[model samples]
Target: MSDLIPGLPEEVARECLVRVGFDQLPVVRRISRQWKWEVESPYYSRLRKAEGLARPMVALVQAQPTADDAGPAVHKGSSAAAATGGPANFYRMVLLDPAEGRWTALPTLPGPMESIPLFCHVAAADGGGRKRLVVVGGWNPETWAPMNSVYVYDFLTGAWRLGEPMPGPRRSFFACAAVGGTVYVAGGHDEEKNALRSALAYDPEADAWTALPDMAEERDEPRGLCVGDRFLVVGGYPTQAQGRFVGSAEAFDPAASAWGPEREEGLVPDGASPRTCCVVPGTERAYMLHDGHLVARDGAEASAWRTVAQVPEDARAATTVSALPDGRVVVIGSACHGGEQTVYVLREEAGKGGAVWARAPAPPEFSGHVAASLFLEI
Candidate 1:
């Protein structure tokens, strides 16, 4: 029944409270019972956004810093690395503030386990005011065997919970995307190393899985994106084709729970991995980074990727791209193969010209190989 703060107008008090940075929100809740309710209220988030205070947080499952770390590394040493199937699973989640160039790590995942599974699928979803990070499927750290595990992290609680394990045979390298609090997974190889076309949708809230129609192709290592209202599986090699990737892509309409006819409209170029393919949030625009160039998948016009910018010289070799909510992109990678990793922020020049890349200062610990990444505009 009290105003947000004693002596001030409720509106003025809210404006001050909302201006508090996203990182400080957790602490703000402990200030007072009324303050906690105000910030935790769903409308508080909308009001903060209206006041231009919401921040898009970038999260990465990056390779952990090792004991013998030189300055910045993208992989681990022989003994330390080999424990997690080379440099893949030996990673921990890190958070980066793209605008401020700040780096921090997420809370440790549950269990005695120190690292995430190798090649795990990571996705972020903000539904009903709950910002959650979902990590699913990958090879076991010690045994290197395929796992159907699922883990969910709630930003509000700053803790992780092991969700229901993925149903069916364990798989690895699958395509995954999050939409409406549900995570959709398709393709990847099974425990016996067999490619799969099957797909499933997971509701972390219910801890349940719903089987969807199998994809038209037996994609081995496809990539996924949630573009608009659809989930797209792009560019994966069939079991018979092996390493020869196809340019075709498949789209799944969650509303109808059915896949559209497979299309070959250049989802990814032939023989290239869609590993670098991504969709920028807010803009909801898709993009692909291949060779040394960044291409935007033009949705409103041609439904194709147009060259937007060239990858920064330092990040050309092993690039991983995650876009801020405003569409400003942050690329992290090494100059050459197995080289020191670094950060670069990219912006578009005016007049539909091109892009500019600025080197961002990244702490040595956060400057490493990015196994998986996503952005949550919370």
Candidate 2:
């Protein structure tokens, strides 16, 4: 290989290859079989991470008005309108690199569907240097029917591949999280709109899903978060609630293969919506956007929700909240329904008494309102 690349030694060539940005991998992979193999290997991915060349990126399932559908116009109402038959819009993944202020689109999912699924969840895992983005189940774009599809996108290969269909009945709006290289899904609604208690875990390397013990109670559209090694499922409506969410919560211990006791209330405050909650990566704490304020809870303590900061007044409801490695939190939302979107970063000043929220440069397209979002360090 060193000889093929001329004067460069194999070690130098490897270093050079590992530094290639993920966006350019597809073009570089076409150069030759040797180059393709080198880029696709797990070792190369690890090399990139080890060399501190990997970038942090945020992936979101966003909505934008469909080009042809001009239907009746409505001001900003709820982000849910995008999927629930609001003005004709399409949902797709959009990638943003805060450090570089760059936005790019991954290839459209490999399917014949005209629009992406509604209510799908996305989770990413670090595969050596190559990162994998896994998109889980949601409703059919055209028929509003439940689906069991699973899609995985590999940064190294720059393409999307289908994963095994979710086991059992198709469920949508479930709680999902990526932990220890595996993705765990629990609680959601079945095709008949019945809340579900079953749960499962997926291993991307093996391309298989194994059954986990069922949750203690049926939950629909629950919020899923990874706290330390445990997967916590909180809030969600019961089949009878018919869209009225409860504050009960439970945690699944993979090692014990069982769900711990359920806190009937407090995990999520009464009247606090679960759709606005997210766990800051690496922080055993979960945050929720409630009444224009950011609230947090320590995973070890039950019902310890505390006010963290007030969200920008313009951000009516936090559609998504993500935390950077440095403990800074990024919130995306609009001031009013159908208002211009904005990105706010909450960071602590070294000598300042408390953290402050400041506006961050964001592309206008992101303002369309985020339906779902996740952060992954490349």
Candidate 3:
């Protein structure tokens, strides 16, 4: 045990090791075999959380701070790029540690792809004790055509690698979510611009995708969520009825390997987009930005939604409402269309006066447009 860290008591060494930030872990693991095993042990991360040392990090697909790697301002391009019309701005992935006000830029997307697709969706899930994030399907930046690409990022290795792309028939604006280490995607438009009802699940561990049964109806640009163990595909317009949302939601039961018959209605207002929505971690209940408020959907089967808190006014426009693993909701966006992007975190368990939104200071480099954002605790 003394070998764990030259001459130090094992328990004291462990306490020092557990306090190391996630970004510094890859280096720490290389110090020695004993140190590697000690940090990678299942209990290492658990101890960090129990001791309040685990930091909640947010990964964002945002506009580049400089003129480098910009893309055209098109239908599916980043809001930041379109807002600042002088030049096409390329989107890159960045990680932010709000507690420390630190930002880390991830390696650029692989191959000829210069930036993340304009509308590609991102989902985070646990993979063998390491935090994993996946980015899937959006219009290719180079060609402006739908792409079937899949890219996975591992926090432990601090690298990006390509995964198996979605099976044929590339789609766009699909709803996606991760539940129990599996990523699910459904209800988006096909290569022919036709809406689709098909669904599929991807196992990051196996680097494979398996098709699920079709939904009761075809939907385009729907919002996907996980409530408890169910995958909820909600509020998208059918193929021929573009821009006219159906205002209902359906659930996929993974255990039964089938979608249930019932669908809850009033999930969204007619003709409105449901892009700003996310599920609360652990509880698996839905939360979203609705009518200037942050609200949580009642449960897996009900249409009821209760107001959680008012979204900060600056972030009310063009918002990506995601709930952190710590049960805080971080709203990322600007005051109005084309405004500087900022972050506001809502503490769900605040002492009184209802939960309040505390604005996290964002540096200019991290303030470009946000295409999508997801939370991870490591």
Candidate 4:
């Protein structure tokens, strides 16, 4: 009652508090133990209501080739090699806010597992009362070898918990999607033997692994982008190393039983591995980072390759790309060069000069083996 709770109206205060993030609930709980029940009771109900208004928009997180980031020797080679395995140097994880160009040093992996932080995928999800950014996969740089480790840290908690490892080695491999609370990891170079196309999913709640159907193609550093409900597995290297890039594209429908087909639409060069791709959720069109240019893929008709932007020739090898919520594409990192490069945000422009690229700011020192940014919904 209002009288019993002093100045607060029980029903009104509870609903208002529920709408705020969970991290704020504790402060309110300290008001009184009895008020805690009212605030926490409708948390889920409020979540359901809030989901209605929440739009699935992407935001740029961090970029590669950060100031303190290792070096080029680590991220050099085929995108597959750069992704599916570890660098031959010391492994480290550096957290940076791409928008702010800020940096945070994280504790290294436990024990003597020497490896590089080779493939990184971050996802944004709603966690009870707060938003969470979940970073998955890549190897422990200390081991300097392929690692099956999955570590997740909540910016809210500042605490790290080891998630379930992939079904197979996910080092130097590319492609990760955060659907619901589960993170899907597909394809990567497995130096344990050869390149792999195994698909695995990690459930954050249970901290467990579920083996999904293996991709139709044996791919490494292949691009994984979401189109509608299906996860699109695009171009990457095959088992053989003849610089063969797969032209075929396959779609994985979790609702269905198997992979669809290896089609020409949304396909890359037969031997040119696509390091990254972006899909404007709810649309059929997609974009791929090929060589040093951004290529567009249209699924309905035949997927055609069109260059959108260009980067420095020498920096093509280790560049990472992602799509922003505004439809502008953000590309970062340099492949061959040794110095720190600027993170470019590309907006569509008329004529044939190329998309207008504006350097937002310099990203933190990223580099090393796994140098890419994952979009989180924060």
Write the number of the candidate with greater TM-score, choosing between 1 and 2.
1
Please, what are the lDDT tens digits per residue for candidate 4 over residues 138-208? 55443445556666655334455676666655466667776555567787776664777788767676678
For candidate 2, lDDT tens digit of each residue in 162-232?
99999999998899988767889999988888999999999887789999988888988888877777788
Model 2 stretches astray by more than 4 angstroms: 1-4, 65-87, 127-129, 262-265, 364-366
**What TM value does model 2 have?**
0.86
Model 3 residue 213 CA deviation in Å: 2.0
TM-scores for every candidate against the unseen true structure: 0.89, 0.86, 0.86, 0.70
Q: Per-residue lDDT of 199-306 in model 1, one digit per residue for the tens?
A: 999887777899999988898889888877788888888778878898888889998989975455656778989987887765557676876898876563465667
The candidate 3 region of ten consecutive residues with least summed lDDT is 68-77
Instruction: List pairs with backbone clashes in candidate 1.
Output: none
How does residue 147 of candidate 3 score in lDDT?
86
RMSD, one per candidate, in order: 3.5, 4.8, 4.7, 7.1
What C-alpha root-mean-square deviation, in Å, does candidate 2 show against the real structure? 4.8
Model 1: how far residue 150 lies from native, Å: 1.7
Candidate 3 structure quality by residue, lDDT tens digits, 23-130? 888888888888888777778877888998878888898877543422332222344445665325477888888666688778776765557777898888775566
Q: In model 4, what is the error at residue 50, expressed in angstroms? A: 6.3
